[model samples]
Target chain A: MELLLFNIFNGFIIGIFYALMALGLSMILGLNGIINFSHGGFLALGAYMAYSLAPAIGFWGALIVSPFLAGFVGLIVERVLIRPLYGRDPLFSLLLTFGLAMIMQDLIRTFWGATGLPFEVPNALTHPLSQVYFFITGYRVFLVALALLATASLFALLKFTRVGIRIRAGNADLEMVSALGINIYRLRAVNFSLGIFMAGLAGVLAAGRLGLTPTMGASLIMPSFVAIIVGGVGSLVGSLLGGIIIGVAAGITTTYYPAASDVVIYLIMAVVLIVRPRGLMGQEGLLE
Target chain B: MKSAASRHVDAAKPADAMSSQKSTRRRVAASALVWALLLTAPYWLPLTGGYTDLGSRVLVFSLAALGLNLLLGFTGGLSFGHAAYFGLGAYGTGLMLKFVTHSTPLALLAGVALGGLGATLFGPVTVRRRGIYFAMITIAIGQMFYFVAVRWNSLTGGEDGLTGFERTNIHFGHAILNLHNSTIFYYFTLFFFAIGCAVVWSVLRSPLGHTFVAIRENQKRLRFLGVSVGFYLWIAFAISGFIAALAGALYALLNNFTSPEDLNWVLSGDFVIICVLGGMRTFWGPLVGSVIYVVVQDYLSSITVNWMSFIGAIFVLAVLFFPWGLLGFFQRRIQK
Candidate 1:
């Protein structure tokens, strides 16, 4: 019973991280048809930034600053690389993004060697939380709480705010929104940057939980993709649900029948594709 | 009546000229060049020292890229998980040699069969979707295979991979073709490569190939024309898988070992790069792309460990500047 509880706890903890990662990718895909393969690279950058800066500026400061730095880089990429390929063939965008992904990965490898870097969890969140039924790590619980809070705030802003309305409108029909005197190009850039920022933030959180590594991005990329696919593409709620499902499934697989853990997520994706081609929460014709 | 007949003749001229003049001769010459190179490479390449190995590697990758071109270029399907077929081929051959007799023919047959079966099963699910969804599904399946290959240690030898496999003797009825000699192995690979290229050429010239092109141009219109789009796509996927497996078997024979790296997504991406860089529309585009990719990768990797970054930069430039690929670029210049 205790073991199951611990697994569930660990699952939710990791699921929140997955949700954070998938949210960014979902936004990018929703706004632009391009699957930004370099989102993982941004996540890696955020993780590395936190790793390097945490020593000097402290962990809290690094967490606050890393995402913006990553976002700034994302802004440059959008303007210089991605903007030109907007109306072109989709394959070109895929190829360009893949190239960018490779570059980011190589750059990280060059700066930080192939080995994993250690990241100490902040002391304030590391305390143990003992309850009547179970005991949980404070840091992990804090991570889940923080993620939920952030997601709620973002959801509220998107649901209520004017800028959020514009972003949603831009996603639905770019030409129509632009015709209404909105700068859709600027909107896309902002949305892309914000997505990157979220990815960067997730990276920092992940580094605290999983440690930082150059090749870590590669592992994250596929799972996040699986999450997005299973959850439904371009839906925030779908991403949240899909992320949790994959995370929990992966966590469970890791505990029992460990050999199948790596593949379990992909197996889930394949099953999902076979059963629900549009994904669990994805709308029809979205992929089209 | 005379004017209309003359108009008809005039209309047929460009189509005839386009097909008969450039495509036919160019294709023949390219095949002949490939054959000549394959025949003479073992002898001629040794003069440069270590060029034989490089030549063989180029041939292997080119053959694999050719398979990819059939699906990506001709069929207009972006398969992000082709490495699954490639790895299936490699592992199939490797496992066969490990347990059964190290007979090249048997191993090749087994690899091709396994690869075909895997593709037949997985293709339906993936081919149901179009564009990015198809690509994503393929990627998911490919990653699944990779994970299985890594975790299933008892069967695949885990992370270290299924190594220690010896080169097999190629059996032809009563006679055995010895692959212990590098020159002999090159000839064997050359034979298969020629056969593979011929098969691809035949397929491309078939009615199915035209249908594939039509489907790529506009699937909805084709569907309206009473064509089963899904069936054609499934066939393309299966054939491509078969060819990739054939390439994998050949690759296993060339290297005498197999590893998880054979099925990596990066390798699949490499094939995509080869197809696009070579000129997807052209028959010999994948061949040219594979040669250039192998040469650049080999040359650059020897010079610096940061070759990936350089390759990345090259990809960016290629996608931006040479959108039609090198062959298209050359064709444009010639046209001018």
Candidate 2:
């Protein structure tokens, strides 16, 4: 029972990470129709930034600053590299981002050196919080609470904020949104930054948990993609649900058949594709 | 105006026919030149600081890219998971040699069947999705094979990779054809490459190939005509899988080793980029692209540790500047 609970909690944390990353990918994919292959790169960049800055500014300051810096980089990438390919085939953007992913990964290696680095968290959070639930460390609880807080704020931002509503509106009908005299180029740049910021946040959290490596984000990127797909491509809430579902599924699988853990998420995706081709919340005609 | 236009077209018919005849001759010459270059590569490659093995690698990758181009270029189906089949082919051949048989022909057959059958089975499921969703699903599906190869350590040898297999000599009647020699191996690879090329060429000429093209141009219109677009797509996907598997089998034979990396989505991206870099629409674009890509990669990796960045930059530049590819760009120039 303890092992099950432990795995479930672990899975829940991992699911939160997937949700955070998928939210960004889903946003860009929904708005631009371009799969940002470099989202993983941005993720690693954020973590690396936090790693580099943590010693100087301490963990809290680095956490607050690193994602924004990553977001700024994303903004620049959007304005320069991504903007020109907007009206072109989605294939071009895919290629462009794929290339960007490679370049970013290489750059991370070049700049930070090609070795895994440890990210140190505060000492207070490392201790177990309860004797009954030895797995419930203070850091784990803090991490979960932070993730929940971020997810809620993001939901609130989307629901109540002006830019968030415009983003949602643009996703529904770009032409209609454009006709209303909004600068979609700027909107996209902001949206890309917003999505990347989530990736950045995920990266920081991931680094604290998984340790920092050049290829750290690569493993998480796929699950996030799966999460978005299973949750329904255009639905943010669905991405959240999908992430948690796959994570919990993986957690449960790990206890009985450890080797199948990595593959079970993909199996779920295949089943979802077969049973619900449009996904749980995918819009009609979206597949076409 | 219509009658005048018709009269002008009728008057220009002879000239148009003459140019077409000239073009046909030029095409034949170009094809002959290409074949001659390939056949004589072993002789000239050493002079250019390249080896016969490099030539073989080009042929192997070209075959993979060509296969992928069938679905991607011809059928407009975006498959980002082709490396799954490619990797399966490699593993199949390796396992057959390691555990089952020593016969290369048998191994090749098994490899092709394994990989092709895998794709064939998954075709219907994947064909239901379109565009970027298609790409996402294919990639996800491809990862399943990758994880299996990684975790099934007892059989696949896990991350260290599968080894202890070598290509054996062939005997036809009384004479023995030695394959250990690099030049001999190049010829052997070329023989299979030629077979793959011929198969793709024949398929492109068939009515089904035309239908695939029509589907690419307008799926809705074809569906309106009551054609099952999904069925044709499955056929294209399966055939491409078969060819990619053949390439993967040859790759395993070349290295005498197989690893999980062969099945990774990164290789799939490389194959797709090779297709785009060469010119997806052109029949021989992948061949041209493969030559440039392989040579450039060879040179860059030799010179700098940062060759990945350079390769990435190449993708960016290719997409931004040369979206049509070398062959397509040249074709455009000729047309103009």
Candidate 3:
């Protein structure tokens, strides 16, 4: 029972990571109409930046700042490389980002080397809370709490902020929003950075748990894509729910047959595609 | 008794006929030039400081990209997961030679069947989605195969990849064809490549091919016209999948090794880039794209460790400047 509980908790944490990732990806897919393949690259960039900044600013300071740094870089990239490709076939943007991902990964490898770097977790968060549940480390609990906090803050911002409302409106109908005289270009740029910010934060947290490697984010990107597909496009909450469902399912499968864990999530996606083709919350014909 | 419309057409017919005849001549000359160069590559390549194996590698990639172009360029489906079928073909051939049989022909057939069947079975699910969703679903689907290859250690040889498979020499009664020779292997690959080109060419000429183009041109219009767009897309997917598998089978034979990388999304991206880089809309675009890509990759990886950066830059530059590709650009210029 303890083992099962441990796996479930672990899965939940992993699911949260996927949800954070899917949320960022979903935002871009919803508003920008481009699948940011380099989101993974941005993720590793965030973690690496955090790693480099930690000694200068301390762990707490670096964690808060690095994601913002990654976001700033994303804003520039969006302005230069991604902005022109808008209103074109999605293929061009997809290929362009795919190339950008390669460049980012290669640059990361060039600077940091290919070896994995261990992130320094704070001592206060390393210890287990109790003897009964030895698996429940303070770091793990902190990760879950912080993820929840971030997600809640995002929801609140979207609900209350002026920019947030505009982003939402843009997602539903871009032409109408533009016709209303809103600067959709500037809105897209902001939304793109916002999505990258989520990836950066996920990276910082993921590095603490999984360690920093140039290729680490590559594997995670696919599952997040599956999460979006299963959750249904154009739905943020659905993405969150989908991520947890697959993560927990994989976690449970890991107990009996470890080899089958990876394939099981794909099975769920296949099932979802068959039963609900439009996804869980996808609006009809909302290609935007 | 001739109508006024017929008389008008008759007056303009001579000029139109001359232009059409000239175009036909130009096309035939271009085809002859390409064939002549390909046929003489073995002799000329050595003179240009190249190896026979490089020629085979180019053909393999060309075949893969060509197959992908059928769906991506002609059928207008952005399938980002095609590497799954390509990898499946390599795995199928490698497994057959490793455990099932020793004959190269049978192994090739088995590999093609395995990869092609996987695509056919999965086509329904993939074809159900269009545009971005289609691209996302395909990538997810490829990852499934990639994980299976990684985890099935006992059968697939795990991350180390499947090995111990050798391409056996064939027997033709009294005369023996030496498969171990690089030149012979190049010819073997070229033979298959020719078959692939012929298949694609003939298909493009057929009514089904026209329908595929129609679907790409206007899906909603075709739907309103009572055509099953999904069904036609599925057919394109399966055929392209078959061609990708054939390329993979040839690739396995070229190296005598197969790995999880064969089925990776990175390679899928490469295939798509090859199509785009060469000119997706052009019939010979895949071939032209594969040549530039494979050669540049070979040359770059030899000199610099930062070869991927250069390759990535190629992808960016290609998309930004020449979205139509080299062939497409030239074709446009000539027309103007």
Candidate 4:
């Protein structure tokens, strides 16, 4: 029972991570019109940046600041490398970002070395809160709370803020938004960085749990794609739901059958696709 | 390149016979030159610090990219998960040879069947979506196979990869075709490559191929015309998957080894880049792409540990400046 509970909690946390990733990826796909293969790269950048900064500024500060720095890098990258491909075939962006992902991974490996780096958390958050549920470490609880806070803040911003409203408007109809004299390019750039910021945040959080490796982001990114897919493309809440659902499903499977855990996520996707082709919340023909 | 006969038929278009004749003559000449170079690869490769096996590897990639282009370049479906089928073919062949038979033909058949069957099964599910959605699902599906191969350690040899399989000589009663000879294997690979080219060429020129193109051009319009766009996409997906599998089988025969990397999404990306970088629209794009990509990779990996950076840079540059691809750019110039 403890093992099952432990696995379920672990899976739930992993699901939140997936939700973070899928939400960011879906944002870029919706507004920027590319799959952003380098989203994982940005994620790694965030984690690595946080790793380097933690010693100097302490863990909490690094956690708060690393995602913003990664977002800064994303802003420049979007302006220089990605801007040219706008109004062009999405294929070019796909190939371009795919290349960018490789470059980012290689660069990360070059700088950090290929070996895994451990991320330190606050000492206060290291101890388990309850002896009965030994797995509920303060760090895990903090992670869950922080993620919830970030997600809630994001939702609030999107609902209340003017820039957030414009981002949403642009996602719906870029031409209409542009006609309204809203600088769509700036809006897109902002949206891209916002998405990358979330990726960066996810990266830092993931680093704490999984440790930092060049391939960590790459491996996690695929499951995010799966999460978005199972949740439904063009649906944010769907991506979030899909992530939690798959993570929990995977968690449960590891209790009984371990080898089949990864494959089971995909199997669920196959079942979802068969039963609900538009996904849980995706509208028909949005992409077509 | 596409079969010479089809190119001839294409050149005979009524709009402008004179330019078409010129284009046809130039293309045929190019085809002849390419074939000649391929035929003499064994003789000249050693002089150029190359080998027959490298040439065979190029053909393997070309075949896979060519197969993928049937859906991506021609049919408008950007499938990023094709390596799943390719690796499946490789695993199937390797497994068959290791566990079942010394019969080379049987192994090859088993590989193609295994890989092709995967695409056939999954093609419909993907066909329901288009563009990046299709690409994402394909990637996820491909990863499923990758994970399975990794987790099924006892059967797949785990992360160390499957080995102990060897390609045997073909028996023609009195005369034995020794595939043990790298040169003979090259010819054997070329024979299959030629068949692949012919299949793609004929398909592209056929009514079915035309319908596939029509769907790519305008899915909604075709739907309005009462054509079953989804079914056609599935067909394209299946055929391309089979082609990629054939290439995978050849790849296994070339190395006598197979691993989960064969089915990786990274390799799938490489195949797609090969298609786009070589000119997705051109029949010979895959060939040209494989040549540049394989050769550059072969050279770079030997020299620098950061060869991935170089390859990534190449992809960026190609997308930015050479979007039309080398062949497509030249053809555009010729048309101008």
Q: Mind giving the per-residue lDDT tens digits that candidate 4 earns over B1-336?
A: 112112322212435878777778888999899889888889999998987889999999999999999998888888999999999999999999999999999999999999999999999999998877888889999999999999999999977789999999989999999999999999999998999999999999899999987777677789999999999999999999999999999999999999899999999999999998888878899999999999999999999999999999988999999986888777776665
Candidate structures ordered by lDDT, highest first: 4, 3, 2, 1
Query: Model 1's DockQ?
Result: 0.44
Which docking category, incorrect, acceptable, medium or high, applies to candidate 3? Answer: acceptable
DockQ, Cα level, model 2: 0.50
Q: Is candidate 1 or candidate 2 better by lDDT?
A: 2
Q: Please give the ranking of all candidate structures by DockQ, highest first, separated by commas.
A: 4, 2, 3, 1
Tens-digit lDDT track of model 1 for B267-334: 88888888889887667788789888988998899999788888887778777887667876776565
Cα lDDT tens digits, model 1, A157-235, are 7789987898888778878999999988888898899889888988888898889888777778888888888998768
lDDT of 3: 0.89
True contacts kept of each: 0.50, 0.67, 0.63, 0.68
TM-score of the first chain in candidate 2 relative to the native first chain:
0.97
lDDT of each: 0.81, 0.89, 0.89, 0.90
Q: Give lDDT tens digits, candidate 2, residues B1-336.
A: 112112212111224777778766877897899899999999999999999999999999999999999998878888999999999999999999989999888998899999999999999989987888888888999999999999999999988889999888888999888988899999999999899999998998899998987777778889999999999999999999999999999999999999999999888989989999988877788899999999999999999999999999998999889977888787666655
Predicted model with the maximum TM-score: 4
Q: What is the DockQ of each candidate?
A: 0.44, 0.50, 0.46, 0.57
Q: Candidate 4, residue B22: CA error in Å?
A: 1.8
| Candidate 2 residue pairs that clash | none
